[model samples]
Target: MASKVCVFTGSRSDFDRLYWICLEIQKTEGLELQLIAGNMHLSPEYGLTINAIRETGLHVDAEVDMLVSSATSVGTAKTVGLGTLSLAETFNRLQPDIILVLGDRFELLSVASACTCMTIPMAHIGGGQTTEGAMDEQIRHMVTKASHLHFVANEMFGQRLKNMGEEVWRVFITGSPSIDSLMRTPKITTEDLSKELGLDLARPTALVAYHPATLDPLNLEAHTNQFIEALSQFEGQLVLTYPNGDPGSEYIIKSFQKLDAAHGDRSVLIPTLGITRFVSALLHVDFMIGNSSSALIEAPTFNLPAVNVGDRQKGRLASSNVISCAQDSASILRAMQEAMALGKSPCGKPYGDGKASPSIVSALKSTLEKRTRQQLLTKKFSIPGEDK
Candidate 1:
């Protein structure tokens, strides 16, 4: 019988990050694919991105309701509780040989918890990455402890996982599968893309993808006003990607939409952009302004310049090609000017080889057979100066 591997994607953000791995698992012989969609993918508020997965010719194994529609932290906690219950039912029914989880989304915590209780080994990607501002920092480490196999985005991350006492042999530095899509993505002619969106291709363009700073107490409207005020000074077209479904997103989206409408040709609001279009836009745009992690990790690969504002993406991996600044209008404007100057400066891809999918699939096929699922299920703690 084929080994069943279940993969979980909670939102468009995480799915985009895991796109290549899902495709690779589908192509691997003797590996059955199961896609469990949940959270923002199921909500119209986030564009129902589960359809995007289906458009790729993949089937949804199970639809899990793991998101709290509200933005409060209390709502988030309740969502986790609900996710654990729903995911427990799903895993008990499927009983897959392994679970595939990516990144540090809270929904993933529930998945890992359910699979751990069912004695199913999980293979976690992006396990050791760090973005200090949000709850993801703690959640990523927790997932790493729960996972049996680790496919980290970079060597530094891989070593971080190993230092956490995970077996070295079980960890693979497979880079980031998300970067693989950039390699296969067809070039998108600016004229065609602009025609598709009815945008003027000749205008100087900036792509903005800011998200909420969980640590910031100011209202979303207040924060967005500063960014919008700064953008009003620019003489170019602005392509704004809506923020992730965090506490302050609704307000941010409202502010961005209102501003975009007022600016007319000067701005456009895009709910979401496909991987191809996003990377393509990065290639053609004069500069990127955002706090989205992609601006730091993926854009630099295309030699794209980014104007990263605020603490949402603070302490995350980035290239010198990115200019960081405070949230005020003057600071943001200065950063954008610098970013426009830096333009596309050649920088090493901070994530990994575009071959991450193949390496990850190879590791799973070879390592799964030899791994001790029972040993993985049994949690052991180490004392000082003691070796396992």
Candidate 2:
């Protein structure tokens, strides 16, 4: 019988990055794929991304609804607790041989904790990367410590995992699976983009996908207001996507509504653009303005200039195309001006060459074959300077 591999997707963004890996697992023999959908994907306020998953024809083995509607720190903490309780139940029922989790969301961390207690080995992706402006930085590290197998985006990240006492044999540098989607998906045309967004794509346009800085909770509103003020200086159409389901997201959403209302025809606000449409929009937009990881990781794939405002993406690796600035309006405007001045340019491949899914699948297969459940559960701490 094939080994059952359970994949957990908490948000649309995580699903997008993990889609190809799931597809590969489904096609490969001796691997039974079980998908557990939860968190923002189940919430209607977050674009009901579960439907998007269904449309892809992937079977969802279970659905765990644990997101709290409240956007406060206390609410987020409670949601994580609820998610852990619910996931424990789900794992008990599913009894998957291996659980695969991606990224550093609190929900994913909850799942990792449940898996660890359940004695179910987990495979984690996007480990060892830093996001200093948000709590995800710590969550990512915690997940890495819990996971038995690691698939990182780059060698530097893999080294970081090894430095954290993870055995070097278990860490694999698989680049980023999101870049695989960007390379394989066909670009959406200008006519189609213009028709869908109801904006003239002939002129200069900017795609904005900012999320709240979870670390700077007190200054969320102030930072968002400053960002909006900076965006007002731009002359072309501004297309904004809704923020992620983090604490203070409500404040960012309200700011986006106000910007849409104020700009009218000059700005468009979309609750969610999905992944394909988002990548297509990247191809058409003159530049990207936001602190979204996509701006730093995926935008450069299209040679798109991204004006990354605020410290939300503080410690991630970025290309020459990414222009970083403070949260203030004047600094953001200046950064945007600099990005526009660069115009269209070629970007170096700091992420990968768009082939991460296959590598991840291979690593999963090999690791499972090499280690039993008990062996994977028995982890030893490695000192930073210890000889191999």
Candidate 3:
């Protein structure tokens, strides 16, 4: 019998990262692929990416409707609650041998919690990493403890899992599966992107992809406006990608759209771009100004300079090519100026060498065929006289 593995993708961001791993699972004999689409995937506002997955010639085993309609943390929490409730039913029906989840989105946490209750062993990716500005830090670690197999992006993350008392044998340092998309797919050329989007490739360009810091929403508009003001002063073309489905995302999207409409030939705003086009655009651009992790991890491989503004991505890895700045007009502009002048930072290779998918698949096949959960869940206690 094939070992059944169910993967959850709630947003375009996570889907892009998990695409290669899902393909790997599908190709493995005796490994059944189940995709559960929820949250933003169902939302028409964020491109309704479920169809995109189907377009790839893959089957979606289950569809869970769990996006809370409102735009607040309370609404996000409600979405999590609903995801858990719906996923319980889905899992009960599928009875998957393993549940695969990636990253630290609130929706991923709900799936992890539900799987924990059902005693379905979870294989988690991208844990043992930190993004202190967002609440993802808490959700990521919570899922880490509940997981049976961990595929972290780097050695540091694997060590962190060990420090947390997780069995070293259960953790695998597989780097990031996201980079696999770059390796497998053909690179998009500047001419192709320009023709597709009617963007002028000759102009000095700024590619912006930003998201809200869930921890602090008070200065959302203020910070957004500051970045806009700085970008407005630039004498070049600008392309902006909409933010993720967080509380303050709507405001960011509106601001970008407004700027595009007002700035006519100089600026273009897209709600979302496909992976190939996005990565290609990143390569063709002069500088990336945003807090998106793609700027941190993927851009470096292209030798692109990234100006990461604000705290949304507080505690993540960045190459020397990346410049950090506050969410203020002067600070952002200063960083942008530096980014335009600085040379490409050598690829750190800290996140992995784009071989994450195979490593993950090999481990999963071995674990699933074993058909028995390892007794790696031992707890440590302070023994008497252990302290010197």
Candidate 4:
């Protein structure tokens, strides 16, 4: 019998990163792919991205509807509580051999918590990366401690897992699967993408894919206005995406709406653009303006210039393609100038070599063949000086 591997996705962001690995799991012999989508994917407020998953020729084994409609911190806390409740029941019914989850989203904590109580093994992708500016810093580490297997983008991240007591044998330095999706997917022609987006991309354009700094308690509106003001000064067409469903994203959305109303023809605002279209935009746009991980992880592959505003992605690895700036009109405008001048040059790839899917698949297959669930689930605490 094939090893049944279930992948959990909570939002379009993580789904995009997981897309290629899911494809690899499906095609490889002796492996079965199961998918569970919940939270923002089920919420129409976030573009109902579960449809995007289904449209990708992947099957959804289960759907967990657990997001609370409230937009406050308590709402986020409740979403996690509800996710754990629903996923606990889902696990009871599905009985997957192992679970796969990615990134630092709080929803993954819900998935990890359920798997831990059930004694199911988990393989966590994007482990060991840091985002000091957001609550993800804490959630990512929490999931890392719970996961049985680790697939990280770089050696630095791989080592961090070891420091956290994960045996070296369990942590695999398989570059980010996001790179695989970015490089392998066929390009959407600029004209077709422009038509789909209803924007004339033939002219100079910048893409804004920012998300809220979930840890930042103050200046949500002030920080948002700073970036909008800077973008308004840009001499090119602007494409803005709605923030992900984080606590203070409401502020970001309202600010974007005002900018849209003011800028009219010069700006195009979208709720969500699935992976393909988003990557296509990166391929053609002059530069990116945001703190989304894609700016640090995927844009480097395209040699794309990205202006990373504020602290949302403060400590993560970035390449020359990224111009880091403060969340102020003057600082953002200065970085935009630097971004425009860079103009699509070669950027370093700190994430991986754009072929992480096969390595991850091979690791999963090897672990499945050689290790039992009990063996995989057994923990080994490494005292750095003592382990060696």
Candidate 5:
């Protein structure tokens, strides 16, 4: 009998990260793939990205309606509550053997919590990563504790999972599936992407994908002001995409609109760029700007220069292509200069080679075939140097 593998994708952001893994599962001989999408994917305000998922060859088994259209932290919490209620039922109906979850979104918190309560063994990808500037840092670790199988992007992350009391045999360093998705997904030529987004590829270009700092959104407007001040002077053809669904995304979206409203032809705001288009943008753009993790994990694969704004991505591993900056205009301008200077040069990317999908699929199948649910759920915490 095929092992049932259900993948939960809450937004456009994590969906891309999980794409290849889903496809790999669907193709493998003994793995049945199931997909459940919710949150920003179902919201028109977030570009109704569920349609994009439908366009993908893989089928979406279910859609959960859990996103509250509030731009405050309270709404985020309520979304979690709703998600747990809905996902509990969803899990009951599908009853997948293992749930594959990626990243550290608030929606994922609900998914993890519900999975834990239901006694479903979870395979968590992107665990053990830290972005201390946001609450995701804590949530990622929490998901780590809840999950039974850990698929990380690097040995460092696998070790971190081990440090968190995860048994060593349960951790697999499968790297990141970003490169696999980017390489396998049908490419949109630079010209077609340019026409689709109404930006000229002939000129210097930068792709901006900023997200709100969930940890400190009190000064969101101030951050927006700083972003506006920096982009206002940029000479490149800018392709700015919508942010993740979080508190203060309204302010961040407004900042993008403000730039488009003022600059006209110089910049364009794309509410949603699906994974294919986004991967295209990564390839063609000379530089990237924003706090989105793709700037660190995926961009370096193309040797693209990325200006990481503020401390949102403070603690993640990065390559030389990433230039750090404060949200202030002066610092942004300085980092922009450095990013341009660095250009697209070959740099060592820590997120593994372009073959993470097979490794992840193999791990999923091997673990499931060898270990029973009760055995997988059993965990033993061990200190690194306790014996010594």
Candidate 6:
């Protein structure tokens, strides 16, 4: 009998990262794939990305709506609580043999907690990564503890997972599935992008995908204002995407809207670009300006220069193409200028070689086949410097 693999995607970004994995699981003969769409995907404010999932023809087995409209810390906590309750019911119905989750979104953490209580073994991806500027750092580690299987983007992450006492046999370095999307997804031409996005790609352009720094203690509006001021210094067209559904996202959205209004045709603010369009934008844009993880993970594949502003992505592994800058307008402008001047160059990406999906599928198949349910639920912490 086929092993039932249930995958949970809470946001469009998470879905993009998991797209190829879902496809691979669906094609594998001994694996039955079940997808649960929740969080930002169901939120009307987040571009209704569930439609994007539907358009892909991947059948969504369940829909979990647990996003709170409020964009505050309290609201985010409540949303997590609500998601836990809602997912508990969903899991009760599906009763999947194994659950797969990726990234460190709070909603994903909620699902992890529910899965832990239900004694459902979880396969976690993107564990052992560090994003110190937000609360995701702690959440990522917490999810790592709950997960039975760890699939990381790089060897360093795999090592970190081991340091956290995860059994060596269960942790695998599968690279990033996002890199697979970058290498395999059909490229959209510049002309096609011009027609679809109504922006002339012939001239210099920068793709900005800034997200709010959840750890910033002061006024997030001030930080966003500085970012917008810096972008105003750019000489060419700016294609800015909306922030994620974090606490300070609403403020960033308003700032982007204001910038878009003032800049007119020079700037375009899109709520979501999906994976293909985003990868295409990376190909054509002269430089990327933002603190988005994509700037570090996916932009390197295109040999694109990314001016990563602020500390949101401070501790993540980056290639030569990435230039870090402070949140202030002057610092961001200087970094952007440097990135624009540097232009594109040959670069070595630390992420995988565009073959993460198959390896992940193989690992899932073998792990599920060999490990019993009781073994999957039980974990023994491996102390550092001690032989397994």
RMSD per candidate (Å) reads 2.0, 1.0, 2.4, 1.3, 1.3, 1.0
lDDT of 4 by residue, 139-219 (tens): 999999999999999999998888888898899999998888888878899999899887899988899987788888687
lDDT of 2: 0.90
Give candidate 4 regions above 4 Å deviation: none
Minimum summed lDDT over a 10-residue window in model 4 is located at 379-388
Q: How many clashes in candidate 1? A: 0
Worst 10 residues of 3 by lDDT: 376-385
Clashing pairs in 6: none
Q: Which candidate is the best by lDDT?
A: 6
lDDT of 1 by residue, 1-95 (tens): 67888989998877876777878888888898888999889887778888998887878989987788887677778888899999999988888
Model 5, span 81-161: residue lDDT tens? 999999999999999999999888889899998999999999898987889889889889988999999889998998888
lDDT of each: 0.81, 0.90, 0.83, 0.89, 0.89, 0.91
TM-score of each: 0.94, 0.98, 0.95, 0.97, 0.97, 0.98
Candidate 1 achieves a global lDDT of: 0.81
State how far residue 133 of model 1 sits from its true place (Å).
1.7
Cα lDDT of model 6 overall?
0.91
Candidate 5 TM-score over all chains jointly: 0.97
Instruction: State the displacement of the C-alpha of residue 85, model 3, in Å, after optimal TM-score superposition.
Output: 1.1
Better of 3 and 6 by lDDT: 6
Off by over 4 Å in 3: 343-345, 374-388
**TM-score of decoy 4:** 0.97
Sort all candidates by lDDT, best to worst: 6, 2, 4, 5, 3, 1
Q: Which ranges in model 5 have alpha carbons more than 4 Å from their true place?
A: 385-388
